[model samples]
Target: MTVTVQPSPRPRAARSSGIGRLLIAVYAVLALGAAGRSAVQIIERFDTAPLAFTLSAIAALVYFVATVALIAPGKAWSRVAWAAIGFEAVGVLIVGALSVAMPQLFPEATVWSFFGMGYLFIPLVLPWLGLWWLATVRRSERVAAAAEAA
Candidate 1:
């Protein structure tokens, strides 16, 4: 008699290809960076630019949520990713324009300032990629479901 061992399959969420892995890596890094920046700004010199610091904190929260949502499995998590990424895109555009058009209003740069120039515009482009990724995942999921049904 011989004993054979079978390896457990990867989780559905973790089964994503390289694109998914890359997205997770980028989002996680951005989340950590934004969180640290906001914490220091709010703690040491928030009084100097309360609005800017507050916006940084908000950006951090958005990034954090997006990161988790992208990694989680299920329809609910996908919706969360959509909402967070959509909000990020809108926030970056609005804040970027405001920062450029009325510099005095900011007094200090937030994460979305100058269209995320401080982060090399990754913040500007990331949401678009995230949205695309979510759509791709959803499409694939639908295809899988249809195949299973058939």
Candidate 2:
């Protein structure tokens, strides 16, 4: 009797073609939204709700960083993309609850307020979308690599 062990599948390290571009666009929008809101919050009302503004600033930084990570073409970028999106998912959920349950605590709205109602729920949805986009990127990259290998 003969036994064979198949090698495990490899990790993906590149972006999809068209889908990658679309993901980049979505990330770009997220980055823009977060950055803009954070800027406003920090500049407009530093004394009113410092915590909320600080969260917004961090969220904005995360979104922009995630966008850059996903857009870059490499393995390190994939790792960064995963980290950023995961953090974003958690941030939205936590901030959403806080804003809803503790309205008084928040002097004004942040991006993740009311489950991202202000951004039309984009903040709530973008992380999931980003995961999907990254998956697509990985799959396409794998297929392309396989084709080349073949």
Candidate 3:
């Protein structure tokens, strides 16, 4: 019997594109802004609002991690993105409420204070968008894989 030859599979496409690229860009910008703001706040006026300044630093770290995670490919990076985005959402909510309910606690606003009012509420809204994007990407990938199998 003649041997049947099989063609090699093509390389998988990159996951980060379109809205994914937009998300990464936003995260990168936010990361830079937060990091710079936190650095100045911590160095110059930490004593004025320790809680707020510390929160700013934390927000910066989260943003930085999220930006990197969103850009990187692999399930591990996706998990990191999930964790960072979720934590950012919670931080925004808690800090926003605290800043409003007890203004005394925050002599100065953190990046997340006022639900990220300073950043046009992007902090408040971005996480949900990111989560949705992640879910959509996962679903689409699954559908594609199923279709390929069939």
Candidate 4:
């Protein structure tokens, strides 16, 4: 008698595909830009616009987290991506509105100011794109798992 061993299912494709790589690159650039700006603002003129500088730092952190989540493997990273992207979306909307309504509150521009108009609205659009990509990845993962199980 001969025994046969089934080959293990192929792993799922990485989340960092063409568009995903573009997204990661954008997030990385934004993270660096925000962090540098915040550092300069805090170091040189924190007293002038503490709120704006602090918000800039927060935006930097969000970008960095989202970038890492996008590149990292596993469901946990996907969850983190969702959370970070969601927070970024809300932050942009709130900051944009507040900046328009109460410009006095922010003496200097933050990363989310004016809905990231300074950055060609990339910041405003990136989170939505990330969420959409994550949804696609999840659907594909489910399909792959089902196929393997069968």
Candidate 5:
């Protein structure tokens, strides 16, 4: 006997999911921030805080990567986003800790500095939010898969 089955609807991702939009917005802000700050540091004051500026550049890079990963589709980039977001979470914690514990190490602030105090703690909070969003999406995918299988 043949089983009669309906096809599953395609997985959807819109250009304007509120959460995705917000993530994009945050990443855009960070990209500009990192781009602008890195430019200034490299141009005028690379000598004063090479380490902090480099970290800022790195933060910007991660944020940009995370932003693209969020907006784009597919399992590959989703995992990439997860990895980048996790790194962001770690970067914030590590930089926040060092900035506090070793004042001499960071004369000024990186984006991850002081738990992203300069960005009103958005940097501190955004990665965790990204991770949570990714988890939620994955769970939904699993539920959808199970339903389709049934």
Candidate 6:
């Protein structure tokens, strides 16, 4: 006679829980809003504020990537989320500082201008929140994987 042991199943990542659902929803809305704003800015008067409009487009892309990454499964998506959220935070900080120091550089506003003042600073805050969520999810995954392996 022979006996075999099966490993325990892994626990779900934190990103798939209730708070994650809310984060996904917020990211989706931000993506949509930024896309629309950037599209209008680029199409209507690209020459007037090319840099700002370009930054807006970039911000929109970041938001979209972050939203998708948050909903996606696996460690790969977690990495993507980290990259996207990190870039967003850096971009917002740089743009916010530049816009203040050199107002002429931003004749118009990008999603990150004045730390997303137009959006009630959501753009500034979102990336930090996303990073926190990703870190939490990754930690939980590691613990779960170790538990399963044992």
Top-lDDT structure, candidate number? 4
**lDDT by residue (tens digit), candidate 3, 1-150:** 999887644334333666988998899899999999999989998899999999988998999998888889998998898899899988899999999999899888899999999999999999999888888777776776776786
Local lDDT at 90 for model 5: 96
Clashing pairs in model 4?
A: none
For residues 26-82, what per-residue lDDT tens digits would candidate 5 score against the true structure?
A: 888898898789778868888899899999999989988988888888888888888
Q: What lDDT, from 0 to 1, does candidate 1 have?
A: 0.86
The regions of model 4 sitting more than 4 angstroms off are 1-11
TM-score of 6: 0.91
Q: Which digits, one per residue and each the tens of the lDDT, describe model 6 over residues 1-150? A: 898887657765767586788889988999999999999989999999999999999999999999999888877888888999999999999999999999999999899999999999998898898888888887887888888767
lDDT winner, 1 or 4: 4
**Rank order by lDDT, top first?**
4, 6, 3, 1, 5, 2
Order the candidates by TM-score, highest first.
6, 4, 5, 3, 1, 2
- The deviation in Å at residue 6 for candidate 6 is 9.8
| Clashing residue pairs for model 5 | none
Candidate 2, residues 9-126: lDDT per residue as tens digits? 5655455446666767876777787788788878987898888788878878887788788777778888988999999999899999988899987788887888889888988988
What are the runs in model 5 whose C-alpha is more than 4 Å off? 1-16
lDDT of each: 0.86, 0.80, 0.87, 0.91, 0.85, 0.90
Across residues 24-78, which tens digit of lDDT does each residue of candidate 4 receive? 9999999999999999999999999999999999999999999999999888998
Task: Give the range of the ten consecutive residues with the poorest summed lDDT in model 3.
Answer: 7-16
**Cα lDDT of model 1 by residue, 1-104, tens digit:** 99898654322333135587798888889889999999999999989999898999999999989888887877788888899999999999999999999999
Show the lowest summed lDDT stretch of 10 residues, model 6: 7-16
- TM-score for all models, in order of appearance: 0.88, 0.80, 0.88, 0.91, 0.89, 0.91
